[model samples]
Target chain A: MTDEQRLYSIWVYLQAEPLFWLTLTIGAYLVGDFCYRRSNLFPLFNPVALSIIIVSGVLLIFDIQYERYFEGAKFIHFLLGPATVSLAIPIYQKWALIKSNAMPIISAVLLGSVFAILITYLLALAFSLEREIVLSLLPRSVTAPIAMGISELIGGIPSLTAIITIITGIIGAAFGTFTLDLLRVKKMSARGFGIGLASHGIGTARAMSRDKTAGVFAAVAMGLSGVVTALIVPLIIFLLKI
Target chain B: MLESIFLIFLFQLVGEMIQKFFELTIPGPVIGLVLLLVALLLFGKYSTSVKTRLEKGLTTTAEYLLGHLPLLFVPIGVGVVMHISFLENRLLAVLFVIFSATVLSIGFTAFVMEKLQNLGNQNDG
Candidate 1:
């Protein structure tokens, strides 16, 4: 069938039975993740990297529209909130360690958040962009969904915010650890905290792959950074009167 | 596994409660996490069997989901196709901000955290 026809059929089916896209997302995720673990290609074969590739192809081949896919795929998206929440279990298990390291965590997040915003704004201004556009670029280091909302609040573009969020996540995943090692960062807690503060979910995922301790710290940093940035970024924006 | 599921459910419920009552922008998982941490601290040590099972299930689930998590952005990619107009208008600005912010985030995070660790050690010494 032509792509349009296929999309139409999928849409009709979706109207009646809506679980298809969710299943596809999960299946694609599983297959891609398995291959990534097997292949060990850091940048190229990353599961999120691969899944996006495979799923995109499937959607094209099936002539499925993005909206149709999103209808069911939201199941996976909805789980994102709880999945992030679930990190609490591990965090709870390691509360003592976290408590001991709390100072470093808070300090790292504060410094990291400031650095992220300052650098983004500075670079954007250097490039000679207008004010609103720069503000839109501010939240790129945060998660995409959150970034989108923040961008809107600050009168920036949501679509642009999403793109920036993804780019930030990928770059952090690819180069975060290399830089960590270059700096001779030895403590798993420090490494994880830095990654989480910078990359959010993507960084947390990378940290988990390294070790459980790293993952636990990354979770703490990611959660706290999100909270801090959500409040702090807007406040900074408000205070700057920009 | 069952306990983890139950715990996660309870945690999720509490998260919803906080979000609804306080209208907190923080996601539910985060609140659930804070709650779970309090519970664990209050209870102290738990039976290992349930904990292990839950961890096992969570491990596989987290591993599977996170690995391919980025692919979930594909639909968003197609968004660029639609927003091609915005792209052409601010292409340089967008690329510059994303690329720089990304590199900066990694660099700044490493720098600050390392400094904090050093400061932490110096104080202890």
Candidate 2:
């Protein structure tokens, strides 16, 4: 065989390996991270968004199926489970603060989650979007992995839910502080908890950069809201009978 | 680090089993999180030093994972390309819904939280 044919054979062999795609996934994210940093960590320059665009473009160009790409990338995806379990560490660490602020945190999360779900549902309905689309949007305020699971359980497209969740997070990260400032909500705890309740991890990251107190509250809010949304969403769906 | 990861996975495995047995809607990882939180709370009440050590190990691993948490979602995000058709005509509507809901929800929560906190302070005073 000619050198060109030999190179083609090697390419075909590498494509079948999980390591190749896993490396590509990480490499693509690094590039996205570099750009994100270069832009001063702007919320709009979201690393996940950039990485998705790059990876998707590559997959499209190569005609590689998403399932094939996922086979390798699942290694990274699997960490989401353990990472979630680790959330308990921070919650445990901040147990005292949580206990003291229990009333406000609990009330705010419950109100915020219900408002988010209800508003999204009403708007989607008014726009006359598809039913499944509306269901996917219901959990858009939650973290991506949990939101995606909720979407799947509720008969919506999981991938679509992931995108919607990310978009919602970006919006929260971008405009959360600004909105809070406009309302004259100066307390760092309030600001952080509000953003976290509405936006999840991305918003928490943004809150962290602003203040340590805000970061802790944001993290706790994100964790609490995730659980609350999961429980209440099904209940709401059943009650509304939609 | 390995031990921390093993413990996390063990919790998740048990969480998964619980979910399966109860036929609940809650996901395994989330259930794992609550279980771990309870375990830590209980353990902390009994032993501070050992709890601190365990927490330190878990913190290092958790932070490492969460620091790059955004990266973990890339694969699923890329899958959006597959569902591009679903989003094509409704992109504007989706964007509007997400934007408005997020902004309003954030504002409402912050306002209420701030008010409640102030009320608590007044009572204390």
Candidate 3:
């Protein structure tokens, strides 16, 4: 074979390997991170958003199927579980703060979760969206795994729920702090908890980058809101009969 | 590092098992988190040294993992490709709902929490 054909064969071989996609995922994220830092950590220039755009652009250009890319990238995705469990460390470390503010924290999360669901539900209805779409959107505020489970139980499309959950997270991470600032919510714990309650892990991650106290409270809020939403969504479904 | 990772995964495994057996709505990792927290609390009561060691290992591991937490979600975010057509039609409505709800909820929660905290402090003082 000619030199060009030989190179093409190597390219085709690498495309089928999981390592290739894994590298692309990490590499794209690093580039996105660099840009985010360069942009002075601007929320709109979010690393996850940038990484998604880069990876998606490459996949589109190469005509690679998302499933094929996912095959390799699932390794990273799998880490989300352990990472979530590891949040216990921070929660434990901040137990005293959490214990003292338990009442406020609990009330905020409970109310925030209900508000998120109610507003999303009403808006989806106002838009006259389909029932399954509405159901999928209901869990959009929770973490992806829990949201996906809730979606399945509530007769929504699980995959769509995952996508919606991610989008909601991105929106929250991008705008959460700014919104808090607008409302004059200056306390780190309150800001973190609010973000986590409305946006889950992604918001917590953003809160982590901003402040340690914020990070811990965000972790606490993320876990609490996950449980609260899980309980409340079903009750709402039963009450509304939707 | 390795031991911490193993412990984290072990908790997640047991959590998954429990979730499956009980048909619980909560995710396995979350259950694992609760279990790990309780374990730490209980272990701390018995031996401070052991609890500290465990906490050190876990803190290192958790920091490393969570430091790059945003990276983990990239793969799924890329899955947006599969729904381009579906999103294209409903993009405006979806964005509107998500944007408004997220902002309003965050504002409402933070505002309420801050207000409540101030109230508590005033009462304590």
- Top TM-score model: 3
Q: TM-score of A-chain in each prediction?
A: 0.81, 0.79, 0.94
What candidate 1 gets wrong by more than 4 Å, as runs, is A1-23, A34-39, A144-146, A238-241, B45-88, B122-125
lDDT per residue (tens digit) for residues B45-89 in model 2: 676776677778898887677667667767766776556666888
DockQ of each: 0.40, 0.54, 0.62
Encode model 1's per-residue lDDT on A147-217: one tens digit a residue.
Answer: 77788888998887776676567667666777777777777777777777778777777777666677788
A best-first ranking of the candidates according to their DockQ comes to 3, 2, 1
**Winning candidate number (lDDT):** 3
Expressed as tens digits, the lDDT of each residue in B7-100 for candidate 1 is 6777878887987798666656677778876776665566677656766775555555444445445445444433446667778667767766
Q: Rank the candidates by TM-score, best first.
A: 3, 2, 1
lDDT digits (tens) for residues A17-71 of candidate 3: 9999999999999999999899987878888899999999999999888998898
Q: Which stretches of candidate 2 lie over 4 Å from their true place?
A: A143-163, A173-188, A201-216, A230-242, B48-52, B121-125
Interface root-mean-square deviation (Å) of every model: 3.9, 3.5, 2.5
- How high is the TM-score of chain A in model 3? 0.94
RMSD of 3: 2.2
Candidate 3 per-residue lDDT, tens place, B19-125, comes to 99998878899899999999988786676676677678899999988889889888888997556566668888888988898888888888888888887762211
